[model samples]
Target: MKKITIIASLLALSATTFAQTWSVDKAHARLGYSIKHMTLSDSEGNFKAYDAKITATKPDFSDAKFDISIDVASLNTENDMRDKHLKSADFFDVEKYPTITFKSTSFKKVNGNQYKLVGDLTFHGVTKQVMLNAVYNGTQENPQSKKLVAGFTITGAFKRKDFGFATEAPATMLGEDVNLRASGEFVKE
Candidate 1:
C-alpha cells in the first residue's frame, strides 16, 4: 500500500509539471479577416479588442486547448462610415451580439510546425464548427520581458451565411466567404 501511494503521488506531480497556461499578448497579437469587396477588391479588417486563453501539456502545443474572444464593436477597416455600417443590424449587429468567441474541440499536429485545429465558432448568435490551419512559430524567451512566449498563425475561411451573417449586398457584390488570418503571441502564465 505504501509503495502504491508513492507511485500515485509521483504520477500526479508529473501531470502537474507538464500543465501550463498561456495568455495572449494583445499588444503583439492581431485577429483579422478579409472578404471580397464588391467582388472587385479585398477589404481587410481587424478587431482591436480580443483575447486568447491557451493551455497545453506539451511545449509543441500538440495537445493545446484554446478559447478566444473578440469584441464585435472593435471591428475596423480604416473607413469610419463603413465601419459603422458593419456594426449595424445589416452586418455584425454589434448591439445584439457584442462578442464573437471560439473554443477548440481538437488540436492535432500534422507536421513539424503545422497543425489542424477544429473548433466551434460562435458569432452573430450562431454557433458553427470551423477548421483552421495553424502553424506554430515555436516558443522562445522574450528578451525584454524575460518571459516565455509562443507564436502561432491561424488561417481559415467560412461562409458568413453559415453563421447567420447577412448583408444587403448580393453575392456578386459581396462574397460569401470570410477569410480569417491571425497571428498571436502568448505569454506563459
Candidate 2:
C-alpha cells in the first residue's frame, strides 16, 4: 500500500510538471504574405481565417509541437477582382484545395530567442518541407483574461514555381518568390 501511494504521487507530480497545452488566440494572430507584382511593387495580402494548435513542454517553447491552418477562401488582396482571380483555378483553386496547412516536424533553438521551425506545408495540392525563422517575442499574463500568453513572429520565403503555382502567371508578370510573415499568440490552456 505504501509503495502504491508513493508511485501515484510521483506520477501526479510528473503530469503537473510536464503536461501543458496552448491554443492560438485567433483574434490576436495574423498570417500574411507579400509578393512583387509585375516587378513594379510589392502587393500584400492576408488570410481572414486561421487557427493553430500548439503544445509545449517548456516555457521557452523548446521541443514544442505546432500545427496551423489557413482558409484558402479567406485570402484577400484588398481588391475584389484580384481576390477572385487568386481563388480561381489559376491560383489557389479554393474549390479543390480549401485550406493551407502546416505541421511542425521539428523546432530547434538557434541562439537566445530565435528558432528554426521545420515543417511540412501543404498547399494547392502540393506538400513540401519548409523552414521558418522564428523569434519568440516573449510571454506575459494577459490583463484582460489573466491567462499566460506567448507570442511569436515567423518569416519565410518560397518559390512559387516549386509548388506548381507558376504555370498560370509568367515570371515577368508575377515574381517567383512568395514571402510569408505570421504573428501568432497562444494562450496557455
**Candidate 2 lDDT by residue in tens digits, 1-189:** 999999999999996789578888888998999988899999899999888877877878898888998999999989999999899998888999999999999989999999999999998889999999999999999999999999999999988888888477887789899999999898999
| Per-model TM values vs. the true structure | 0.92, 0.90
C-alpha lDDT values of all predictions: 0.93, 0.90
lDDT of 2 at 171: 76
How much RMSD separates candidate 1 from the native structure?
Answer: 2.0
Indicate the residue-level lDDT of 114 in model 2.
Answer: 99
lDDT of 1 at 188: 98
User: Candidate 1: global Cα-lDDT?
Assistant: 0.93
What is the TM-score (0 to 1) of candidate 2? 0.90
Point out where model 1 deviates above 4 Å: 1-17
